[model samples]
Target: MSQNSPTAPFSAAARPELTADPQRRLGVLLSHGFTGSPASMRPWAEYLAERGYGVEVPLLPGHGTSWQEMNTTGWADWHGAVEAAFTRLRADHDVVVVAGLSMGGALALRLAADHPDDVAAVVLVNPGINSTNKQLLALPVLKWLMPSMPAIGNDIKKPGGDEHGYERTPLKALASMLGGWRQVRADLAKVKAPVQVFRSVDDHVLDPSSVELITRHVPNASVTLLHDSFHVATIDNDAPRIYADSAEFIRSATGV
Candidate 1:
């Protein structure tokens, strides 16, 4: 079934309704990266769901569609998607942990910081906090000057992955991402959840400094640097590593 957009949520009304069973192991909310779909988090979601944890991987606004749609939307819509999923999970589970990829990591961090009492824990993969990548940071103004700019470097998994990207990313959207990260970083002290961050030592898109910032800012944080993969570690060669780490973190935090 095709997923819903930001404003149009999938009709949970049609599926057999899930009972609010408090005895279930735990609930995990998976957030995908910017310009990505639930596809990015589906593997992690499936793993958690199969292991008796209720999991939700909602598609963010202006994503999983044509790039033009994403260009029109802002980061707030993406955060809204995360907030909506978290609220739903809270209704049925006593504990909720979040796992996010790239930009989604930023959203997860922001949510944890904002609702410290509600979020039990978080697992971040290649979280893009301080994007010092010169090529990406200069895209906004550069795009305006040259409307048909060449595509950014191929940053996805090597063998196969989503290739549908914005031919010309809206400069405003790029700016909004950086701005959101700044805000998320500022509120790191408010985040009480124990965070486990996975960094790709060979990541081409984000610098090591971003991971360092994440580890330093969060009050309680742990870092693991993976050597083999790039930015999309969730689907790359080291995906199993991410899966194992996330599951372990959930178990540790919720005592499940």
Candidate 2:
């Protein structure tokens, strides 16, 4: 699609790539959140790529485009994209680390659960596995009536930071996301990889219930608090902490 097209699958500012490094034996696959583009995860991917590690940041299907287009796709489409990237990285790298933000985190966890031996570790920032929002329960009926609700993008506290996600949230796509959330939570115990989570102290998008559910099920998961940032901590003030800590987690988990 043309970059200027309104229906383009990606934003002009967002640069998504499957970066391959033949010399690097380690790879990191980073996934962006639901309705969001690779723009949010680009900086994190660049950090790992600059350190000589292979990185893959794929744009989820139906995302980066308009919300109406996103409503046509489902969770399987998004997960399939991430799984493909992981499989490709596993073929080339000695070890692979999977990391994500929000809904992306749920996808990463699902990958670790499904392929325990292939994933070296998992890093999550403000993952959304469970929600206390009662409005979600009405999604099934609301999707047929209303096409979308308000946008949930650019929840970052930092100035001039934009996630480049959809301006509206498609209800049908959100219902599909809820299914993915339930499946991931059901298989949380199957995740054998070392998992590290970074949670924000003041998140406008997700509640603490999500974090509580994840830590309650996942075995020996470590949680860190981001005091200054909001939901999009990957681009907030605490982003450096996430980058540094995740690198350390990868090294310790993979023995690299």
Candidate 3:
């Protein structure tokens, strides 16, 4: 799922103080997973911004509002949102790296493929490319009959480092994610930008073999395995590694 900050920002005061130097040319567009908010990605955005890389973590449609609102939205809305974010980044930065967690990773991969010229590289953390979890696939049918399921995770991991949210999930929402993953896989061959995929061996949600399938299909992909983390490796035990490795991969790809 894509996430941002704990709550929506009211104005400029809610954002981190960034430099106004337009000449400082580096940038990164961050996408959070489905059923999540920009709050989940804000920490990483802050990390990169502090290092002088301008970053924008956008709120996807249906997200950061309510579960019912998210159910009404689909993959197209989410992709369009990211596309707009990338367009703005391209107009401002010399180098742009796309990064995401879970479903957000799928969106990032799609952007890298469709806009290869605009993206310098990509970083995926436990990307929910394909559901290794069979239970989720079965959820849609159940959701059709019963829309809301109990919350999936123990807690919602926040970008400001808080884990609190309704565990109740919308079945249709997960179905939308599966559809997006299928589309992303179909376009994998076109993603020429180098990719760094971080997957946790202990990820409870995604199948471990999904990592191998990703490396095999992605044209220029490198894989990193996290032995001890869960699905949210971006904020779990291996978070530091994911953060460091992503920065290194971006540096290598952009030659910065």
Candidate 4:
């Protein structure tokens, strides 16, 4: 990972040990949370690749850089990169799954909703969609008044865990992200594929509403609670559980 520089992107292709058959190929597109770089998702991507699945961890446009730059961008920008990566994988593999960490999970759901027949399955780790913070309700006006807020990165329970993410959360970008959430929430029923979520029971970042919302709205959605991690469970103590179980879920869901 070269120390997983917050400035870089990450990607890997399928290296199937048995054959070159496209029909046997499986692909996954992973997205990191807002203000986070590919560093947060690299380990999972690499693990999936080693398991013979094509993986892509794209650095969202406004991420891997200063928060000031992020304030200039929003949800559409990030989701565009994800959709493009999914498109590329779809062209090469017959079955494709989308997985995400935090806000990335929202993007994954968006993909599954937008392409019901294409996305084979979905895996989310400590996803965030709705928040109880009243401040977000005022984003239409607050975004103009406040440029940023406290950062929401590195919320891992494991010692020495680092996501190499931004130190500030952009208000305008956040507002746009909330808008994205609305879009996905409204289209939740469009997702027809199997959905699996690894939720951190003791997460300090995202509340339980997200999992509740998913299981309630998205049919075929299920949850696996993480007892030993925080919001960034993808890189925390329960990360191995997420990786191994997610791989198994993919295999079972796709009949691979």
Candidate 5:
């Protein structure tokens, strides 16, 4: 089942974004956070593609258009999108590394957990497997009464950084995602791939509990704290560090 990946050591400066060595079937699948579109993960995706790793960043269902539209969708829709993308990438590439941000982190974990042997590696940025928001416990009833509330996007510490996510939080969709986390928590121990987590010290969106749970359950997982970034660390001050480390992880994990 093992396959060969990129062999040349990863050097972002040496390889331009336009050129990808097609000699090896190495690939990466990047999923954006909730309420966000592919634009949120564009920079990272482009960097990976340019570095000669096949990259695919899919737009989740009911996102980018409006929060109201997202309210109509649920966890099943979003997860299904990423799952399909993974399947497609797997067919084209010999090995695929699954990565995501925020809710996308949970989605990626779900893939790694379910298809432990299939996923070559896992990369998560502020993954949310659990939450401290007690209000979410009441989602069973609240989702039907209200459609949405205030937004949770654009939590970047950088002045000009933007995730390009929704303006409002969709209640129905939020409840569905929260429910999905329960399954991820139970299956965390099932993840067999090497996991890398990039956590922001001052993230205003996600609680630290999810990171704690991830490190507690998953083996061969390492955490890197991001001091100058917030929840959206992919585009924050530590963006370069993420890119460099991610390339390094792929090189180390697959022995490419």
Candidate 6:
């Protein structure tokens, strides 16, 4: 996994889709966080796929490629990929649930806000909505001078688990992520789907304000606090809880 490699088609660890039962009519679209590949969401997707649900985990543009390539892309490119996946799921299923991790959560919220009738429910794990990091205030200026900063992946507390994300964080792409957060935050009221958010109490990557902002606006959004996980709770110790709770949430929301 070189940081200078060229962008290619989905790799074995990049994107994986599973078709459970053709007649299930229930679909799920799971998106990975910024700089992350489908590897992070594979386990969760598989869990649902094995239970007779159509699942698609897409690799966002510039991800699963190289950090340099990720630098060239923006939030629009990432959101576009997720939106396309969601559209495909809607076409084949009577009900669709959108779930994501970190920045992917922001994208899911955006989709729910834009297509409320299409999304049956929304589930997020350690979603990155707003950041309290002071460095972000200088992103507009820093992105012109510095191409990247330290990596922000692999925040899982479970040892040996990997998120398969970039080792370097691209500033320009990060600024674009922040822009998406701002947009989603403003339109949170437009999200009419049932929202279920899982927050890790010990997450080191995201600020508490992020979840606060989400619950404040999403009207009746349910928040589940993870006591024993870091930012990447999808692969952390509480992963099973997320899987089980989300499964129940989807079943209860859509009656599938």
- Scored by TM-score, the top model is 4
- Kindly indicate the candidate among 4 and 5 with the higher lDDT: 4
Q: Across residues 1-256, which tens digit of lDDT does each residue of candidate 3 receive? A: 3233354421111122343344447678888776766666666666776766778877778776778777788889999999998888787777778888878898999999898877889998888777556676577578679877766552223234442333567678778777888888888888889999987777665675556767988878888888756776666667777777777777678765
Residue ranges of candidate 2 with Cα displaced over 4 Å? 1-24
| Tens digits of lDDT, candidate 2, 11-117 | 11111232233334887889999888787887787787766677888878898768999999999999999999889888877788899999999999999999988
Q: Give the number of the best model, judged by lDDT.
A: 4
Q: Which stretches of candidate 4 lie over 4 Å from their true place?
A: 1-7, 18-23
TM-score list, all predictions: 0.85, 0.91, 0.85, 0.95, 0.91, 0.91
Model 5 clashing residue pairs (backbone):
6-256, 7-256
**CA deviation > 4 Å runs, candidate 3:** 1-5, 9-24, 136-140, 154-165
Report every candidate's CA lDDT. Answer: 0.74, 0.84, 0.73, 0.88, 0.84, 0.85
- Model 1 residue runs over 4 Å out of place are 1-25, 134-158, 163-168
Clash totals, every prediction: 0, 0, 16, 0, 2, 0
Runs in model 5 deviating more than 4 A are: 1-23
The local distance difference test score of model 4 is 0.88
Instruction: Score candidate 1 by lDDT.
Output: 0.74
- Which runs of model 6 end up more than 4 angstroms from their true locations? 1-24
**What C-alpha lDDT, on a 0 to 100 scale, does residue 107 get in candidate 5?**
96
In model 2, state the lDDT of residue 254: 73
- Looking at model 5, residue 158 earns an lDDT score of 86
